[model samples]
Target: MRAIIIDDEPHCISSLKYDINLFCPEVEVIDACHNGHEGISSIKKNDPDLVFLDIEMPAMNGLQMLDQLGGNIPFQLVFTTAYDKFAAQAFRLSAVDYLLKPIDTHDLMDAVSRVKLRLNRDVSRQFDNLKYNFGRPFAEQRVAFPHRDGYDFVNVKDIAYCRADGAYTTVTMADGKSTLLSKSLGEVTEMLPVKLFERIHHSTLVNIQFITQFIKRDGGYVVMGDGVKLAVSRSKKDRILSLLGLERW
Candidate 1:
């Protein structure tokens, strides 16, 4: 896979390139740039398969650089940034891959793998999501749920619950709408923010805000806002109850 590294810090660029060379040898470092302008020119010239982009830079930040690209992006982007709480959250909501600075070999290799896997897939929406949410608060941030056909963008708060459907998951919105995800329940859980969602059963994931009441009968279930009863597993009972701040007694 042809790749490019774009970061203002020379050391960061060097370390990332070295790790890519050592661990992920399949990805060729086609070019490296010190700022967004050079990065844009390199992208136009190389048309690389993957780009490792740093968020902050002088004059033109990464987002601004992307805006300058006019949304005609063909390369997969994996953002690399120093750990800022909000910036990390924006990446997650954007459903784009990212590596925290002082990069780990494992994460670097994994990011490379993702880029190669999704090289030809559409990423315009992912870029849009990041750009849109970067300036917003966590509550206002929306997530782009990726399924087989494409992505379904929605507010995390609107998701009522998710049920395991074989290898895929079915996300039921609070308004009785549903979207099928091409990921397993476990995988879908990873996509959601943990603070607002909880696994009450091996087959069920619920948005804490939409849970109306807990029923002890029928192997224990929770009533959702839409009157759906989702079972709670025996093993996860105490922990989920504790998380919900509900007393079993």
Candidate 2:
């Protein structure tokens, strides 16, 4: 498989090439780029089968460069980064692989092997998810939910509340539409910003911005902008109230 490496650190680029030659002999190093801009231009020129990308760059980061592609990622991406925090975002983008700095030979081979197996699968959905959330602050992040045919990208601000049912969670949007996600509530909870979303009940998480009223009736329930009443668990009632700027003395 043809591949290119995009990293600002010259030593890392050289090390990756060495590892590929020794361990991942199936992959050929086509071009080594120093920045995202060069990576973009080289990608357009080489049209390689895989790209070893770096997350943090001077002008355009890896995600930013992918965003500029408009739609449909042209090649498989294996992100090489120093930060472990970027792993979540990388997987959300359906990246073929992620390797931290001081790339491991065994891990490199394993990632490449996975890439070879999934070269034909459609990763556009993953890209859509990345385009919405990558590099953005929690307040600006969006969530991707798989629907019947494609995926739904909803801004965090547009989410009213999330209801958990068994392994699935129903996400109610501000527009009165709800979508069912196959993921468990606990899994989805991690994707949302804690400051913007608060878990009120064991099965309910609500967007604090969408909450319009806090009723002190029957233990307590919060009224959303759409007039939907969500019951708040006793444990979370005080915290939820405090989050809404209503402190109980």
Candidate 3:
């Protein structure tokens, strides 16, 4: 499969390239980038099937780059880092594959094998679920909302809607206030109650209870109870209409 290596250290990239070629014969290393910005741009341009990403880099780190990708992240990420203590924890939390620095040949093979297994195992089904739930609503009540500093409790009913602002999500409250969340719209959407919220666009999720009116602009927009207008995607129009109990207008 096509793959790209992203790490700030040139030697790390060189070591990884050698390991992949020697141990994991199937993986073709198409390109290597020095930092997260170039890494992201390369991924967008090359559309590789897998990415070996380093956790820390200048300007944009690996996690930050993933956050910036939003719904458009094309490849399965295999984080390559020297952070030993957090490695096991990260894998446990997200089912993510990773390899440590000063790479071990056996570990490299194991990681590549796992990648192949996951990619071969009904990836289309996984993609389908991912698409349907891309920007699907959040169930705040059940989820422990995360802040940059730490986790906080958020009542599901307190949130009026969610707006994705490049690399961050703005959680608009019912009381006319907004909080910037560190999570992506997709990540936050999974935490929200789908029954109460629905993704109406690539960048927006609205509270079903707070919808004031369905304003059909030249494109389509939702008028909130507070007179705020939010854009809706054409792909989501049918779902939005169904939620509103209205036939096509």
Candidate 4:
């Protein structure tokens, strides 16, 4: 795939280009731009299949640049940012690819693979979702789950609990339906806001809003809104009690 690398830092552009050349032989770097201005012209001239865009830049940030480009962007985009959890959450909910600072080799390759698979698809919706989310409150923001073909966007409030199954997580909605996410439980935990989700057990994360009752008898478990009961770890019991504002029963 023909690609463009856009960043404000020269060394970043150089390092990313070198990495791409070394690891992703299939992704040719057609153009490397210093800032948003150069990036605009480079994009027009190169018309790359994929664009690696840095989010924060002086004069014109990536989001501002993208805003000026209008809504009908024709190429697949991968955002590069300095490890910010909130920003990454927005990207995930939008199904937009993002790489944190000091990008990992495995991560870059995975992003490339996902981009290749999603090529030729219209990404206007995803972009719009991402932009909209940046301005919205965390509680109101929706979560997007990646599937085999695309993503399933669901309201964050819809999730009742997340159950870990080895490397994957089973996200159960309040309605009792569950979707197995490719991400591990720890990874999944990062995607969720800690204000709403509590790690009740080593293998389970429960949405605080879904708790119906906390049974203290016989090892301790919380009954969810969906009538599902999940165990609470002894270490986390006090925290859960504090979160629920409950007196020990």
lDDT of each: 0.87, 0.80, 0.74, 0.88
> What TM-score, to 2 decimals, does candidate 4 have?
0.84
lDDT of 4 by residue, 120-146 (tens): 987877887788787577778887777
1 or 2, greater by lDDT: 1
Model 1 C-alpha lDDT per residue in residues 166-226, reported as the tens digit of each score: 9999999978999888889998887777788889888899998898888887788889999
> How does model 1 fare in lDDT?
0.87
Using Cα atoms with residue i matched to residue i, what is each candidate's TM-score against the true structure? Answer: 0.89, 0.71, 0.48, 0.84
Better of 1 and 3 by lDDT: 1
Going through the candidates in order, what is the number of backbone clashes in each? 0, 0, 5, 0
Off by over 4 Å in 4: 164-170, 174-187, 247-249
Model 2 regions lying over 4 Å from their true place: 14-31, 37-46, 59-72, 81-118, 121-137
Best model number under lDDT: 4
> What's model 4's overall lDDT?
0.88
RMSD of each: 2.2, 4.5, 16.2, 2.8
